[model samples]
Target: MSTPSHAAATAPRRRNETVIVFALSLAAMVVSMMQTLPVPILGLIRTDLGTSTAGVSWVTTATLLSAAVFTPLLGRFGDQHGKKPTLVAVLGVMVAGSVIAALATSLPLLILGRVLQGAATAIFPLALSVLREEVRPQKLPGAMALVSGTLAFGSGLALVATGLLTSGSDADYRDAFWMATGFAVLALLAVALLVPAPRHKTGGRTDFLGALTLGTALLLLLLPISQGHEWGWASPRTLGGFAGAAVMTAVWVLVERKVDEPLVDMRMFVHRPVLMANLAGILVGFGMFANFLGVSYLVQMPEALTGYGFDASILRASVQFLLPGAIISLLASPLGGRLVSRRGPRAALGLAAVLGAVGFAWLALDHRHSASVIGAGLVVGAAVSFGYAAMPAVIMASVPHHQSGIANGINSISRSTGSAIGSAVVTTILASRTLDHLPPGVPPLPAESGFTLTFGIGAAAFALVAVISRFGLRGGHTTVAAAEPAAADHSGRPTDKAVRTDTADAAV
Candidate 1:
């Protein structure tokens, strides 16, 4: 069969576009659920597999690392080929992985399954790219917000499902994987039936070398972080891994500048808004995960073991935090869209950054007291949701449509890396400090202290993001207003009146 021509392939139809958005949103929700499903079942997985804590931990780490390595590569592929096929392929991989995990007899096999499962993470960026092309300019912001919010909702639901499904039995972890498998199947079917074939295709060589360099660098960095304590942090292996990661990252930067089709367009970093958004994404990601991790420990800590002592089971604990965070994310996402529409992406982003910083600070300060801790978490969750949802809007508004996928993939990688670093840093601190203080049979206190310290660090990081968002993003408004009209014209919606009004106002 002959390849479809670019214009004929991408020509937007109103009805098909809406269906595509819905399909993509559904896919995003399915993919995001993978991130949180293992949380409630971590202890059970360890016990059943007869795995060391470090070995079992790889189940989650492997998935994040795989997603970090694959997301941009898949996004670039979608840009060159088409989104529908790429998304379907990823979903299929996730289903296969879920099935493998459900049937696994060993921790190694389960880790392999998790790696395969992580491929679905790319579906989120691919969906965003598809929506950027299919949706109208006016509806784009809201659609993007809805899509992003689905990620939070899915994650929360997955946690709840894990808790409910795994409550009384050690075998229940398998049920969680089955649930994921079912979601994947549903997403794949929806995509096949609803998402129309592409009308346009872009031709570009896959940046295989760039992908290798990035993948290698990420592996080097993440391996040590995920396994350093198990391997002995002071050991030669750990030091070597960190050294290799740094060198590889430097080499990748050099190689990226020379390549015709770099996996990530490094030049995009020069754009003030893009740079600021990415930086903010990193900080927001760090803070978000740190908070989640800390709260997980807090909720799971037995009443005899901790302050604000409650005897809630894992299921109840997961549900309590999950519901509030999900609700806040759901509410904030649409509000971010409205804010972007009224003021600009910069304003919305700034507001999110400030809110995140404040919320995290509140959580840190109120560590020992009050039910307001949950409210603080909700605020932080909402702020992160708003920031993340607004970022795609800014990137899409700033860049060309064809490059949206790669742009978003790079953004995704930043978030992933941030999370990896946060997990490593937080866990390391907790482990190191607690090593000395465990009273004979008593559980650890350093873990709890580390949780507090990590949140404090996260709060500081987000505060910095707030500063950058306020200053770094201001330049984008003028640039966007200037570029948006031309982009609209190319999309066959001339912004003549808006341009004229903007120009007149500027002159005055």
Candidate 2:
């Protein structure tokens, strides 16, 4: 075994480092909560804004679009400079956005604020980067799991809070933004008070060209997909957006090949673990968000019209989902860390994928009953937390410490892209099936059917992911080899002699 180094011993001795980790982690959780705040109130916002259901869906689409665009860019900046300043900058922008959203009267302005909020969500990934840099290896697994799980837990909490606050007679949808503002303020203060300065300063040229190209490409791609139905999917504007996205992505590939300091390292795509992990991330994201979309509709369906007997108000419906998801998140986060330590990332990921598939399948069958719904939600949430935690661990293990930020940024982007696709797919199905005009007191069976089918589809997707993870993800323990040549054999043994001996015994 390799000896524990002096650097590892000395790193945690600094008082400010501890504070920084705690503070940044908490801030990241708060930022994560903002993403889910509007989810519980999506229906309310739709009614209040007097917008089409499809149009109201864009509130989520807008935030995801901005998040997908900015996550990699901000992460790259953090890697090139330092996480502290980047985090603070993101928090400040988010605060401004929250204030704007709180005061907004128009749907367009609300979307603009959401866009800014999404941009600021990059702080979660940046915090992970910081943790990787500052925390000791021994402590990393748990810390990383906590960071990953917080996204789910915090979002659940935010949704629950929104449900409770908005259920009151005095509160409106705008109160959610104000709540976000308060969270942002607390995050900002925490960052200011607790985060430590980086020990090593970053030395690299900024890849402005790459950033611009990628940004343009993502925007072009996301715009059409996000608004295609509203704009007439086959209309000239939608077609033009698709064409522009294709051209920009093609150019981006060429630009990345030539740049010394590429914003995203295209070569990471070739690494088996990184590539497979990202693919898994995408599928998992799709599966996870599809569940969210399906459950939202399922809970809102009137009891007299549906399989379940409980007729819950909007607030109660939100809680029914939030409580189970939060409990599962809390349970799965630490469990993921333990699993990673024992079985390696590939095994952990495979297990998570399998669990997700089972969860979704269970829901498809059991959604008729309220208890079953909660149980299925818990299972799905646990699977998601596990998968989420394992993904970052896989990426961090596969790349150099310096490139962790970019690798994670890419992972985040993959998840966001998957989420966007999930949203679009679910929305399209519901829209295509549901009639534009509903007669008074008449229910939307087509919409309800669409959601059921979507959940089934998500279950199938997760099943495929589980199979792929089992076979496709290799080099689990050996992931550290990709970054550090000396640490190639991560079997925890010291030398190649030990590796050969173990191989020989296994061959026998």
Per TM-score, the best of the predicted structures is: 1
RMSD of candidate 1 to the truth, in angstroms, is: 6.0
TM-score of 1: 0.88
Residues 1-508 of candidate 2 have per-residue lDDT tens digits of 4357866766565565567666876786787777778987877788788888777877878888788778888988887788888889999989988888888877898889999999987887788777776666656666677778877777677878888889977658998889899989999989876776654445588788887888889889888877876787899988999999999999988898788777766656456667878888888878777877677667776655554435666677768865687768866888887776556566667778777888888877767777777888888888888888788877777665556777788888787777767777777787677644566788664455676678788888778777656666632342222223122233211233211111111110
**Which stretches of model 2 miss by more than 4 angstroms?**
1-21, 43-56, 232-236, 306-309, 434-448, 475-508
1-508: candidate 1 lDDT, tens digit per residue: 5356755665546567677778888888888789878977888999888988877889998998899789989988998898888888998999899999989989989998899989788988888877766676666777788888787777777887888898884455788988888988999999889987765466778988998898899889888876776787889999999999999989988888888767776655445556767787787778777777777666666545454324557777677765688667877888877766655666666777777778778877776543756787888888878877777776766555556777788787777777777777777777776535445888565545665677788778877876776676554442222223223333322233322212222210
